[model samples]
Target chain A: MTPSSGASARTQPLDHKEIVAAPRTLVLVGNPNVGKSVLFGALTGKYVTVSNYPGTTVEVTRGAAEIGGLRWHVLDTPGTNNLLPMSEDEQVTRDILLREPEYVCLQVCDAKNLRRGLLLACQLAEAGVPFTLALNMADEAAARGIRIDTDRLSGALGIDVVSTVAVQRTGLPLLLERIPEAGVSKFRPRYDAAIESALSELEPLLPAARLSRRSLGLMVLAGDDSLQPWLASGASAVRLERIEGIRRALASRYPESLRFVVARQRLAAADRLHDQVVTRGKASAGSALARRIGAWSTDPVKGIPVLLLVLAAAYLFVGVFGAKTLVDFLENTVFYDHVVPWTEAFLRFVVPAGAVQEFLVGPPGLPFRETSGFVIGKYGLVSMGLAYGMAIVLPIVATFFLSFSVLEDSGYLPRLAVMVNRVFKWMGLNGKAVLPMVLGLGCDTMATMTARIMETRKERVIVTLLLALAVPCSAQIAVIFAMLQGLSFAASLWFSAVIVLVLFLVGWLAARVIPGRGSDFVLELPPLRVPQLGNVLVKTLARMEWYLREALPLFVLGTLLLWVLDRTHMLGLVERAAAPVVVGILQLPEQSASAFILGFLRRDYAAAGLFQIYQPYMSTGTMTRVMEIQVTVALVTVTLFIPCIANFLMILKERGWKTGLAISAFVLPFAVGVGAAVNLLMRRFY
Target chain B: MPALVQRQERCPLCGMAFDAEGQGCRPSCPLATGCRVVCCPSCGYSFPQESGWAGKLKGWLDRRKEAGR
Candidate 1:
């Protein structure tokens, strides 16, 4: 049959009638974006039919091609990172593998990212699927100084392995010739004794399917609920219940999840195979320099200096220039000098002077307030909200985002993780925790969710706790930097030292208290390169936009809430109620109580409040020693304080109510106690 | 000839390429409904999906590369 004719007939669900009617199938499988479709196009020229897999949105494409003098039904399955399936697309891909009969698989892999590809390869091998490997993107791999010995790999896996650039049709003939020689790989990752025993017992209970019983058993062990349908179809309920019992029993034996243990073994096997066959050469000049710098940045001894240098640069740029210079120009020259006067004049002309005007701009000449008009009041939208969000926090965050983007785009962030891996070990976490922690610097709510990347619940909780307790988000950090600008370098050092100590102490304590094992760190580091200017700018702008959308509104809301409290005389009541902690313990002005109240809404908002209170002290360049100590204590306390409402909600969502509440319960008192202690210590020393 | 119809985005963090539209956030996430972040199915690394001028810039770059090729 012609390709289109075959495709038209076979594109629908492969029912029993069609399965019998169709020819033997050649299924294309691989990770997404690895040129699977391109390979499919190369195999079956010009005509194909695409249809959704029955009852699902996942599209499955089918066509016919003459390969090695035989008409083969070509099935292009969905791209999947894991055959076990995590998402709908991956589930569909796994389902195709489970359902298809008399099929030979063609596993397309990215040549540069061989380790990740081999993870799927290992899964296929475990499933006893007869497959041929195509290491696509050979040219890109070569460009990046990566080389693979296909012959050695083929020998190792006992299967055909061909290096091809599918887009260029580089090794099409060779791949075509090897298609008929596809064979089941003998490779099997060695699991732990407990898991092996469970698998051995479970295998006999499972009914035969396209995949081996051992593979099915492993899937069960990994808690892959997507396999429920296939398992239900084959195994008796009694057998399934017994399988669950075995899974639970095995799970209880290990501190970590069984899925992590299984994945770790597979990753270990892939790494060994990779080491055996892959070699590196000199890359292009730019990348070569980057590679050298990347190496130095991850080195134990050298990495410290590199990290310190980067930090100093960031401090000077963000703290000195952005906070001091940009903020001065914006706040003084832009807002105080021009915008405030123009806005007050405009509001006076537009609206009759009364409560509405006072509410909008704030009462004229209010005590301790900088400008006149309600909008320029202590809680005015224009004076406090817009000034803090646009002028003070914006410049600081923008600069931070710029520096952070450069670090991220240059591929230094992962290396920073590696450098800190030893320290993370103390916390029962691997270097992988750094990704979320680093992300916490951007936004803790997102980072709390990203903590799912950790292998164990223990590590996730620890990471989340650290994120909530100490890792101030970007805007908060910017405000902190601005606050610190008024203090001595020693004060900054004290704040850093205390936060670091708290992080390690809490992490160490939580690791011991929480019950689970940490996974081995096995992150694949991308080749370092100079940060692209366009990419950095795009990332920075994107982050700035996020701040504008997600955070700026909170500033306005906070100002409005504060304004209402002030107007209702509730501000005095609340300030008096919080006096013991804010004034007595933290030794801050009674006015700083409002900042603490606002801190719960958003950490940056509170910091900005303190910044507003400290502004007079900073601008005059005449901050008293007592004022310096108070600012230091307040900044440190806020940094270690309870996370903002959004992050708290996220923590509750991710960790569930009990753990989330427990975290908050511990953090609140701990933050106040730390602040108190710092108050006493700074008083004694400084 | 299988028609290549779907577009994919590679996760910069984990290098796992996925169909951005198909990879939904966890159902329980409060921000799930209207979140603009594209989460990696494999690694769970969430990043804002590129759009507007950023997307245009990337498209322009890709087209330039294609034209050169």
Candidate 2:
């Protein structure tokens, strides 16, 4: 029989010409790193270049293969954990399953990780997709002492199941023979009453697709927004609204989201199925040791010491090595000695010795001048902007990113979250808040958006407030390290203590003042492994590239703005205007006012400005006790200063304008007030 | 012709894997026009997308590793 003749036409009208021209498709779907690629290559006989699926950036590989004496188009989809479509890759994979006219799936599973594979299989069976199960990596599973009863699993699910080690081409002939006999399984997970009723109501409203209406209804009940396009294609507005109403009614019945409830039910069912069909024995010695370390890393008692050791190592690497050693070598030896002098001379010789030249480097004189620097001059783009970006900030962020990537790749971040769960509870947030809070160290703007993951608005608002007030981005932290490296250990301790104190104090207050309650923390921790060197380098390089592209220009712009203000004599006026705060209250020099002014544009810019100001005091070796106190005060104040423009705008976007404005209004004065108190108390004591 | 395929990125914080070119922030976002950061659709976590040269280098590394294996 022809392929199109048997193709189901319950969804959209089939394109006759297209169906006849296209070969029968066999899609391979599975979890990530499950040997799907190996299976696909074995099935298709060659690797194929991937191309983006239409209207998406998701790449799906298609290759021609002969299975059962029929030409088949083998499609290797992006690995996805769930068909409910959490991310774009998952969404695209689901769409292919829903929209493909005539296709059968080859559900690949890692024999060792049956539970994870079964989770996806349960969803596929519910979708009514005709598929055959290929439990790949059987050899590795046997080595690990994991055994699966394939016959029992097949009989339970009503589908053909084949065990194969794809690398060795085992069971290839059997898998091929079963492709022609692929049939939809009758397996369906029984959800709770509320979800079942909602699905029943939603099923009638959803349009027909390659997937069963029940499956589509489940996705709708899960709040999969990526399905909107597919749902809106031919469905009426009233039907969509009714479907939404049913979803809302069901969601209101539970304290948690419908998505969470649905996911939990599916996972519970997968666990039950797994227990029935699989038996586990002792794992290998290497994996057993890795498991022990992973457990210790998350233990409440043991994890604290691990966390501290990690922090100390990070400080030594990023603080002492990256910030001080690298910055001194690059800034003083490379730029000041060579690049700055050479660029200044070259610009002077190339251009006239007037406005353009002055703008390029800085004015000819040192102290004061009418003209501003552009490239090699005082405010010169190359000297101050590029130098700070490349010489000072680059090494620090590079080292931080490298360490962070190692932590991420080694799977310690989730453990870190687990360790911090209790402290987060005091702030009316769960451990999930740590993800955004920790991410704020990299970039507050992105972290503000990441606040969406928090279950409650109160939790999000508190996290956002704390991020703006106390959490300094990596660049600012780097500059803080640079500024404090010259002082005693007590100075660094004081800065850290003040920042931590403010975070906890404000978080405690916000919990009581905010209107909503917090949710329980439930996080999935991946198995910890050694960090991959290639992955770490790629991630570090990507982040360093981002700093150069997105942040470097802002540094130049901030410098140019300051230079223009100085040239117009406006900078001095602004400084004198704020003298009461700068000189009187804070006891900082009037010139330091520019740092505070530039602090609003970008926190790192202001910190860098302060670093420039503090350099002379350190280099001259005439630093007094009072000078050391001022440095700590300045760093503390800047760290607590207003969020940068990008982050501020994101705050408004995510938290609404009222809460955004209120957060800024509270943070600005609170930061200064704390700074004033610190200054007064430290001077009296020291 | 060279195949047109976008790289995939995973959010380190949440482990949400996504296409690097898909699931951008809203177009109304000021940074959306030329934004190079890949935002996670699942959790809203954002990270810088790899540059072309970095992507090439990674592909080359993976290929060499595969050959060695």
Q: Rate the local accuracy (lDDT) of all candidates.
A: 0.80, 0.78
Q: Write the per-residue lDDT of candidate 1 for residues A288-329, one digit (tens) a residue.
A: 577678889888898999999988998898878887899889
Candidate 2 per-residue C-alpha lDDT over A556-670 given as tens digits, one digit per residue, 9 for 90 to 100: 7887888788889999999999899978888898898998998998888888888778887777777788888888888888889865877888788879899999999998888
List, for all models, the DockQ compared with the true complex. 0.29, 0.31
The TM-score measured for candidate 1 stands at: 0.73
C-alpha RMSD over true interface residues, each candidate: 2.9, 4.0
Listing every candidate in turn, what is its Cα RMSD in Å to the true structure after a full C-alpha superposition?
Answer: 7.7, 9.6
Q: Give the Å error, residue A79, model 1.
A: 7.4
By summed lDDT, the worst window of 10 consecutive residues in model 2 chain A runs over: A1-10
Error of 1 at A167 (Å): 11
Give candidate 2 regions above 4 Å deviation: A1-285, A363-372, B1-22, B32-34, B40-44, B66-69
